[model samples]
Target: MSWRRALKDTARSGIAVEKKRLEPLIAVRGAAGLAIVIALSLWLFGPAAAASSAFGAFQAAIATFQRSWRPRPELAIASGTSLAVSTFLGYLTISKEPLFLALLVVWTFAAGMSWAAGPTIGLIASSNVAIMLVTVTLPTSVAQAAGHAAMMIVGGLVQAALIVLFPVRRWGAHRDALADALAAEADYARRLRHDPVASFDPQPLMEARNAAAVTPRQARRRPAELHGARGIAERIRPVLASLADPAMGVPAEGPARDRVRELLASAAALLDAAAHAIRHGEPVKVPPAALATFRTPDTGSILAGAPYRAMTRLNTLLQDVVETAGGAPQDGAPSGARGTARSAETDDRSTSGRAPTHPGARGTARPAPTTRSRPTFLALIPKALKAMRSELRRGSPVTRHATRVSAVAATGYILGTWLPLGHGYWAPLTSVMVMRPDFSQTYSRAVARLAGTVIGVAVATGAVQAASPGTLLSGALAVASAALMYLLMRTGQFATQACIAAYVVFLLGMGGEEWTQTVPERVLLTLMGGFLAMLAYAVYPAWETPRLRTRLADWLAAQGTYAAAVFGSYADPSASNAPDVRQALLTARTARAAWHAAVARATAEPVRHRGLSRTAADDAEDALAQLGRVAMLLEAHLPERGATPVPPAARFADALRESTHQGAKAIRERRVPTWDAVREALDAWETENPENADKVVRNTATLVLDTLTELSEALDTAVPPMTLDGTAPEKPDGPRNPKDSATR
Candidate 1:
């Protein structure tokens, strides 16, 4: 990537139009609310007050449109209250330039730091600061400022009331999220039928989990179908993978393979049916053949050992999915008692049921899976504060963004005020709206803002000049422009900016500004603000390209920890000192997410990937994904607590932990790493009596070795790879058992 290429890519992205489904009903509702507020304000307080108060309804409506799980009314009220406070506070300092400038700096900095919480919070906060800069200028006296503030609250209230009265698809987002997760699982099952090793992206499941967290107020009113289905979906994914995977003891080309495929196809069909039912809030119509496939006793005879157990688990789980998604009440009765038919044989066998074992093997209780309680809205404040405080370090991207944006904002305001432009606030306002934490968004938004302002300002000014509409008609046009903006909000930044620009023009016209006098000032000031924001980013960019290697290393380390934890459970099934598998898995997920986000951001950056090429990055991601998948498979079969311990696994787990810790450091230092310790551990385990070893432990260990070898090979392609002592790294040995190799 070069400067020229980066600029070209971002420019294209800036102008790209997305095809999105229009929410006509929601758009009309928002527009109607804005119209009602405008009408009342014009009748009682005239144009200036109307102009100031209109922002409350407009912004509150925008807040409701954000992809958040919080209730719409809550978002509206929060947005309105925050805007009113900002406007009221800004009015008190408008009398003195120094005081107002100081207030502006502190406020903008806090808004920048809000990004640590999340994008939704950050955007809403930033919008408030920009709105404050404009709204504060509308009031002349303290009493007038108070009145404007009160009207802003009223505007938010009006929008909230309408939403409550005319609700459209309550819990729609939650239903959609859950449905998407189920749909993704369905797709994964279909893909696995052709290629059992196909990768599955867990992003949809992660989003569903986020949506599942609701405030107590919401939980009381939530639909029954939304409950328990997500957990069942999570359980189904691993079972499907284990059943399809040949390494789990199913033959690649035999009757067993056909059974696996048949089971996969049935699972896919059932999952699709469940997804459709949940998404559309309809009755679940399980395909008779799909249910019959699960009920067939022939499946148990075709697949033996691990595959057989997986089949049994799948049958029971599918019944749960059908019942839960179909909104059937969950009583203590068997799933067969519910609407969906269940296999009598599968129903009698518990997943953790006692089975005939080897002479020395022992059974143990499974550890209870941990669940996190979702925090309430009020409870999240302290968590947000903690997150913000953590990002105060110099190296944090959020901190850098805060510093860069604050500086740009202050400079833009000074230049805007010192220049001859009458409406100087427009300059800094544009800068505030355009800037973001990353290069792509900031540059793209800058371009979008300038173009949209030109087009928007032109159309509105031309219409005003031609129609010569008075205050009443101007208010109507403003409302119409806002409605258009809402309708096109998700289409692209270009259309959004255009509507916004036109809306502003009409709003100011209602306040008695001549189009000829205000038009040139707005266009020029917008260009000035956009350029300032772009220049600030170019000078102080927080490039993710340079950090790609670090992100990869972090992910690798997290994977190693996860693998070690699963192995530790096998080593000492009853040992309280074993690492928490749940916590380890969570850490790995977070690291993987961070790595993906970095890659996405880096792809948009102008700088060349310093250590990793595009192909190398993709390969590395694939290897790591495989590594995580194998670990997840092992986790699915982990020995229960107090089970007979495989002592050799303890040494292997220690070796894995130590070797990967060293490997991560070697990665950061730009040197290829060797897995000599892991190889030696495998060799030692093989040297011990081969026939007496636990088969499950033996097989999964070899899979771990294979994945690690692939990971090492992937990283070997890094640009300018280095080695220690002028020698290449040692590769981990393959499966110790020849039979294990055949199964793999």
Candidate 2:
């Protein structure tokens, strides 16, 4: 985590190109929108107006490319409206430097704080601030500024209209997200056949859940196949794990193990077929081999008890998947109508009780009909305000980022104006474009921005010199550059920035700037702006390394609650506990995702990993993963509602919850958790009705205790007393070097 190593990694990441499939059709649509705006403006208002209008179209096109579940036209319209408002307000203050600078600070700060909502919102908001800096200077009078602002709105409307008319792969992102989740489960099932204890990443499932959240209007128009399948896919993961796990009593090497392998392989095939169908809108094709494996009976077989029950549930869920994937009827109802009901029944059966003695029996508690709803666009205004208010605290990263960006923007503008640069706004524009909330992004973007600007400016300059293109040709070239930008949008920052630079160059040429004057000034101002951004981050940084322990503690606490909820559901198989269990699982997944992201960001920071070393962190994460897996196995074999309730499980659940809450507090204070309460509860249970409890519950309790022990031992390595500066205190033996065992 030294500065030199961090710099090397960030630089490499800055230039790395992602191998994403290019959506040429979508690119063509966006370019056509831009072309329409430019051609109309050139015919009516000339090149100056065309140049100003292109910003709206170009920005709206970029907004469509963001990873969001919202409608694409909505995104374009929102981006255009916001950019237009900023430009008009910016024009009002352009006559007074102090007022304009004050407005710049407020706008940029608001843009930075928008990260609290999500990256998509933050990036679009930031682009508005940057574009505002340039667009405000395009008009010379109040009347002219009003015209420019009106044209900006027109540009956005045109882009939105084009998207509505010629849609490319509508809801394509949602399909891919849901399909990826199922595909991930399919991959996990295959891996478990060989390595029973293999860990599965929950990121895909999390993304699928996000994609599934829909507005009421969207729900009415959604594809039939996209509904309810994700919930089934979630249930399949644990069943696959439990059946293959040797701890669940499947013999390591026997006919039973062989049969389990066949079931897993068959499940994988079915899932793959379902994924392909959903992703590409093709018909689901069931493989003959998979159908045969599912039909294999457990009669006269070595697999019995827990394994037998898991086999039954797996077959039932896969049937649901097949039925749902093919848009077929389930129990004489259309898949769309019965999808939620079947998924709810499926989850209730999995967690509420054991599989029915026969397929005809149902769980005691039935889930009410439900619909997924998300905040409407209007509702988001208050939600965004609340998020911004929460981020106003001193410790919030968003607040720090806002302050940093505001200061850098004002400084860049003042320096630009004082240094006699013809276009002073380009300096602040570059800074706003490159600065981010984290150290790695801020530095990497600075590098990428400078490099891209140099290449883009040079290439455009050479072209202009060779072609000596007039205003009309310049407008065409700008549109072409925009098309290229859209094509390379997802590739990497370096390539996107290069295209943006070229687009800006030709765009300005339409406004009658000579290539000789514009190109050199842009390159020099961009370099200066990038340098200021990098320096500002180094002076006032929000390093993720210091927050690694906090993130880890949060994950530990969430995992404990999830395990408790699973046990509670078994102790009392009420419909209420079912939702609690589902909610706990979701909370744990979110925490785990946050922890992983923190670790990834911290790896490129120059600070020491505050409390946890690299090896200790890995060990701790593994132990937590095992804890979740054990809970999942127990969940797969929950008892029937009328069956005997394990009363002792209720007490153990409370004990686990309290113990982990305390343990998390200890973690934040840089101490190893003793887990005394959990150990005592286990001992009391073992001493009191050890023989009366279900064998599966007893065995799973022991496994949970073992994982907790592993966790405590792993954290012991990170318990060394440390100074405020993230370095270990001197001991009798020696002082620990931060570089030797870094947290990342």
Which prediction has the highest lDDT against the true structure? 2
Give each model's whole-structure lDDT.
Answer: 0.81, 0.83
Instruction: Give the worst 10-residue stretch by lDDT in candidate 2.
Output: 734-743
What TM-score should be assigned to candidate 1?
0.91
Clashing pairs in 1: none
488-545: candidate 2 lDDT, tens digit per residue:
8899999999999999999999989888877888999999899988888899998888
lDDT, candidate 1, at 457 = 93
Clashing pairs in 2: none
* TM-score of every prediction relative to native: 0.91, 0.94
